[model samples]
Target: MSEPETRVASPPPAASVKVLSGVWRGLGPIVYALVAGGVLLLLMGRDPIGFYATTIESGLLSQTGLEQSIIRMAPLLLMSAGLIVAFQAGLWNIGGDGQFLIAAAVVAGLGAPLVGVLPYSLALALLCVIGFVAGAAWTIVPSVLKAWYGVNEIITTLMVGFIGIRLANLLIKGPFLSDRSLVPQTDVIPFKYLLPYLPGTRIHLGIVVALAVLAAVHYMQTRTSYGLSLRMLGASPKAAAHAGLDVKRDIVTAFGLSGGLIGLAAAVEVLGVWGYVRADWNPAFGLTLFALVFLARLNVKLVIPLVGFFAVLSIGGHEAARRAGLPNDFLLLLIGLILFFMVFTEWARTKGWTAGMRLRAAGRTSQREAALDE
Candidate 1:
């Protein structure tokens, strides 16, 4: 009787398996890209290990280096967050640099006069709102063309960005030029308006705001019906329309929201770091941000880490080139290699090569188990 006691078997841990599967899927492509980059460096007669070591030491090992890297990531994070929205809606908003400049110019032109007239908090709030609105306004024409007339948003947005840069130059060199300095920059906002930095570091409130935006966007994309509609539209406009979604409205809304975030980023850059806008001093971060969005597969959760990774590379690349006599363009080569590998991996997955292999293996295992049973 004691030997006949029965015990319940626990079910297989499907949830843990699923979690591991997700982690592997997310990281596998990145690992492949790194290996490809290393091979490229070897082919070029460079020491890949030494390059990586220097990059790590210069970008992440030192406190000052880490602070600088995080500082550089602020604007990239903001632009990527905006890009995620537009890309998810199947829209290409390539004018983020222009939007960023226009927003900064607008805030600079407006904030100077309001600083002394309004309360500090009130003026800061107004400047932020105006920056956001100006950003959205800048994209209105492109969004309309895309939504109503089905124009190529890529071209329109890109052209509009050039116009924005010229306009910013006009504002800074003409109207907003500071009285004290001969430089082509606007008057600095009052010290009271400048955002305070984090204690013991050059990092400021903008980084915190960027993190908040990232979290909020992730929540919106994952938890809301609108996010589902945007994804549907991106996947297939005709199908989304068949589902009775307002495809046109969603397109415009997505572009506006994207531009708005870029504009807020501009405002934060000026208020938090520079406190003024300089003519022809654009970071030209649009292209870099665009690359990062794709590298992260348009996932907000992934954008944060990718942006930080890029910032480190950028800072370390410059340092390494200076100290080791390496070509600065080597960093660009690495980025291009990673992009190529990522694209290839995605193509393979789409063709079902990986899944087919897994299925075949499973079939072989099943057949062997049946033979043993027989």
Candidate 2:
């Protein structure tokens, strides 16, 4: 009888190992943050189990909760899409609130009139285009400064965003203010003129729009030449310029695309939910999503689940915080902890501290075995 052939497994490829390590590095901070949050909850005499249960039950298990969570996700998903583009291009559109407000104002101010004059479908299309243009136009100054003068986009975008918010407020209160209501808001589009609901669900077409936008973004990022250039620019602008890429044009285009997407998110929000743009109404999704996009490592595939998780947290965390006798901002603290831990872990990995600790642990194990043998 022939002897059975011996078989040995080969080690994973270096690339595979690196990918696994990267995933672990990305996810470890989330675990640590969650644990820390639980500990804090316990210290505050709150039941972490109950809090989590409420979050899950209310956010996912209940139909009403799920609808609300999904509704909230629409604009957030859109914002994430914009951030992905900006981050991948090595740009930051931190003024999403401003873009959102401005877009919403434009949509709200004109939506009702358009619906009255044109077909609903055509009106919706025109409003979205207007919103996108408004958002993109708002970034003109920042984009010009960064592309032409090498001014820091962070400062310019932020300042521009502040101005946008103030401008939107002024427009809503002054130019767009509706006489129908006492509230400082633009004229409302009736529910019939709003985005249609999905079949058998209260969720509107906005979620579909968001998903489609994300799909398009992923396709553009992975399968297009423009995406490659943007990635190169983000990795090193000097190198991209050296390679004969249009550095200035790319930077300007990136800012426009980023701002436009955020503006579309705002238009969707108005068309799907609010039907009007109110003064001082800012969901402030920009900052939270900055943390989230980093958490997902700017990978479009990861953004989906992370955004869903955030949407749930935003919706259910309110009830959970209330029940736990905590403030609404408690969720922000948890997100902040996650960001802190992610930064810390990356720093530790870069310093080889994690590898050193593993080496030390292995050495201790080997030494104990040697002692036993002796």
| Leading candidate by lDDT | 2
User: Per-model C-alpha lDDT, please?
Assistant: 0.81, 0.86
Backbone N/Cα/C clashes per model: 0, 0
The alpha-carbon RMSD values of the candidates against the true structure, listed in the order shown, are 4.7, 4.7
Model 1 stretches with alpha carbons more than 4 Å out: 1-47, 190-192, 326-329, 351-374
lDDT of 1 by residue, 1-374 (tens): 24322322432233444455455455566567667777877787777778777787898888878887887787778888888999998999999999999999989878888888998778887888888888888899899998899999999999999999999899888888888777788988877777668887878777988899889889888899998999898999999999999988999899999999899888888887778887898888788778778978899887888888888888887786666567777767666766776677668777867643454555555545544564
TM-scores for candidates 1 onward, in order: 0.84, 0.89
- Lowest summed lDDT window (length 10), candidate 2: 3-12
The Cα error of candidate 2 at residue 165, in Å, is 0.8
lDDT tens digits, residues 1-374, model 2?
Answer: 14323322432234444565666676777778878998999999999889888888888778998999999988898889988898898987788788888888888998888888999889998898899889888989999999999999889889989999999999999988999888788898999999999999999999999999999999998999999999999999999999999999999998889889999999899999989988988888889999999999899888888889888987888889888889988789889999999899889977878743454545555545544564
Clashing pairs in 1: none
